[model samples]
Target: MVNHALQVSAALADMQIFALEGSRPFGEAVVRHLGLALSAHEERGFEDGEHKARPLTGVRGRDVFVIHSLYGDATHSGNDKLCRLLFFIGALKDAAAGRVTAVVPYLAYARKDRKTQPRDPVTTRYVAALFEAVGSDAVVTMDVHNLAAFQNAFRCPTENLEANKLFVAHFAPALQKEDVVVVSPDAGGIKRAESFRQRLSHAIGKPVGAAFAEKHRSLGVVSGEMLVGEVDGRIALIIDDLISSGGTIARTARACRQRGAKKVIAAATHGLFMADAETVLADAALDGIVVVDTVPPFRLHAGPLKDKLIVLDSTALFAEAMRRMHEGGSVTDLLAGR
Candidate 1:
């Protein structure tokens, strides 16, 4: 880890770093970490369900970064989120903010990066177009559901930050060759598992085998999984993008255990525990669960999985990005995670 807190100060006296967000805690963290001032606002909702906003400071010609995450529920409408985002970003744009850069950590509709089914909409590109329509000059997001979605959506430059890099380094030392088996929880994550395997193999200086478990996500039908690689008495690291209801994760652990795996640990970017997820995950898994602090903060709540949960901070990551952009440096270098 770097010793200093990376700073992003405006080069020109007129230029400023403005961050707006849905969650006050995440937004406030970005503001404090970057050493920027906040505009006073009473952002609340009316009884009639109308959102009300009052900006206390003028933001004419300042570069604003709207830091909002939309990755929990499949109802991730980036275009819709952008629609609401415009109410905020547009105000700044009209206020003469020099430019608006979207600092969305969890991208919505990222899964629909391509048209796998007939007549299916490619929402990722649509979300990109929405940002452009709402006057976004650039965007910085973490762990996009689909990598190419960023490039396809924006005319301006976009950076796809990885939470995986954080995990690979953080967890590599504790993993033994026989103790760790890189397992993708579903078929959709084969590419991610391959990348993880490569990282682990290079780190350990040995071949790290890969395994993918299949699960059919329908009603009342359990997934009959077939492990493609060996994991007998080995630690299973099951990695995925997000966990909503905990069905896939709980079942993944169960399936891995049935295959004679010694232990199973789950990791993901977004942890949106909607239902009785804590009880499900806590009772099912053999080891722990690691999640990134991207969406709503997880510490504010309590659950059965609290003892087993590890929440990683991403504030420094975004704050560093602010410094890099301000310094006229390469954002790609941060994404490559070298």
Candidate 2:
């Protein structure tokens, strides 16, 4: 067992965590909020695009958490990124370092949870196994697609965090007193939207119901279809887990307007600007957009439409989570976004 460095108190002090970067500072913000010493990193890249990573600080017996956001091309090529991550993890394990936690703000292969399409691999599960094998004592992530993916892959503990608290805080205020309605962009997202609905309803103290839009493989949602619930003339807030292509948001926002929705807003936990997502969202008729900075919100290439996009910090939230975990307290307190 590693010598844990957190100060022992009635409540645990989250400390000694370090943040590394791969063109994003999501982890940097997270560790900074904890007031922990950032781990010293010495990383360089080869002309051929290979990379090397080393920690200059001694971690011999100290609990160490490594934060990285691993996703797709906007993130990196699938296996290439994983290999890079594993290399770093292996380096730590080889050093006889203390327990290592892999903190992924956005788990990459979550959406492909099941082998819905033919000959598809359960990549998320495999990746989880890779983490355990590479010396991860625990795994922390947010809003993964295959919820069961955690259980299947790791021999160690796995925790998934939700962004409901953050969303309700910002979005409820944005749509205040406007007779707002919470909406899910698809049937699959009804659960996420419903969770948001319950929280918003409790906070605003009114009848906040939920609606959903649907599409069958098209980029945009099916047009001219009445929403699953009454959306006519009500301001709509679309809550999604993540935005990769921005198609669903644009489609749902457009459909809401068609159904007499006075205004539309989009919010998500992760802002994954894949392909022309920034462009698509900018052209959509959304009044404003908000996203948690779990996956770094700085890269949105929305031109003038960037002004409409709002980025909120999730670093503080993650930092608190690390604090609670280190203290051996109930992570459940904030699990459902209380």
Candidate 3:
């Protein structure tokens, strides 16, 4: 028989939470929701653009969870943040942590799950390899670009949390009496839009409609002005995994309005808002945008788009996931809000 006493001891062992520099605020929110204190760590950058991070406290035999969103900011690129997170995970493993789970709220390079062009790099697989190389026992992220590709790329245990329920809950009241249609900005996000529509429909006890905009990209240019499905005189909720430059969402919103959509709103799990994203999304067709707090919307908050932005707190969701993972409890209930 398995050693019951050993299992109990392991279960009772205190878990430590560490947040990397770029994700400190977000991690702090999650820690607060979990009633835990943030662990101390030291990070220093050399004059040569080299940096290092080390946990101040001993992590030997402890269950360690590192919170870091591998998204770029003013000072660091996405690659830089990824490297720092990877190195920190490796460091914790070297320190003999019994287990290390990487909690990446916004997993960068996730969109590059596959190659569309010849000789294109499969960055998602490569990132998964890097995580495995650092000895991560499990990788946890939210609303990845491609679920199948993400699961297939990682050899270790991977958990992808969904934001569908959260979004549905947020929009339930507003859409309860209105005719709402969930729309995918592009054909590739049809699955995501469908999930959102299903959950929202169930929550509001009404049959939510679905629609999609066809988009084609060539050499960084986007085309395809056609929209599929019924959206005329209905509130359109354009859904996607993330919003970077805001071009796709804007294009879809415009198309929806042109198709007689009464109102156009965009909802995404991550709001990257990169490079004049505010300017791009300021079009009159887009009424507002809702996004989860996976990535801090510093730029958007400081700009004119603040009035049109709705940010939902994801700390509770992440806290619950971490609790279940640490206690060896089933997370199925948390997946699609079962």
Query: Cα RMSDs of all predictions?
Result: 4.2, 4.1, 3.8
Q: What is the lDDT of residue 281 in candidate 3?
A: 92
Which runs of model 3 end up more than 4 angstroms from their true locations?
1-13, 301-303
lDDT of 1 by residue, 308-336 (tens): 88888887788778657756677678756
TM-score of 1: 0.83
lDDT-wise, the better of 1 and 3 is: 3
| Whole-model Cα lDDT of every candidate shown, in order | 0.71, 0.75, 0.91
lDDT score at residue 286, model 1, on the 0-100 scale: 51
| Model 2 C-alpha lDDT per residue in residues 1-338, reported as the tens digit of each score | 64444433323332356555562467666766665556787767789988887778777766678887775554456566667777777888787776777788877777767676679797777877788788888888887765665667668898888888888887666555768789998888888899889888877878886799875663443344446877888888999989888877888888888888888988888888777787788765788888877766656654745788888877787788887777676667876554
lDDT of 3 by residue, 1-338 (tens): 99965775465457899999989998999888676778999999999999999999999998899999988888899899999999999999999999999999999999999989999999999999999999999999999999999999999999999988788889998887999899998888999999888889988899988999989999999999989999999999999999999999999999999999999999999999998898999999999999999988887756557789999998899988988898988677777464
State in Å the error of residue 116, model 2: 1.6
Name the runs in model 2 displaced over 4 angstroms.
Answer: 1-15, 72-79, 218-226, 302-304, 336-338
What TM value does model 2 have?
A: 0.88
Report the error of model 2 at residue 206, Å: 1.2
Shift in Å, residue 44, candidate 3: 1.6
In the predicted model 3, the residue pairs found to clash are none
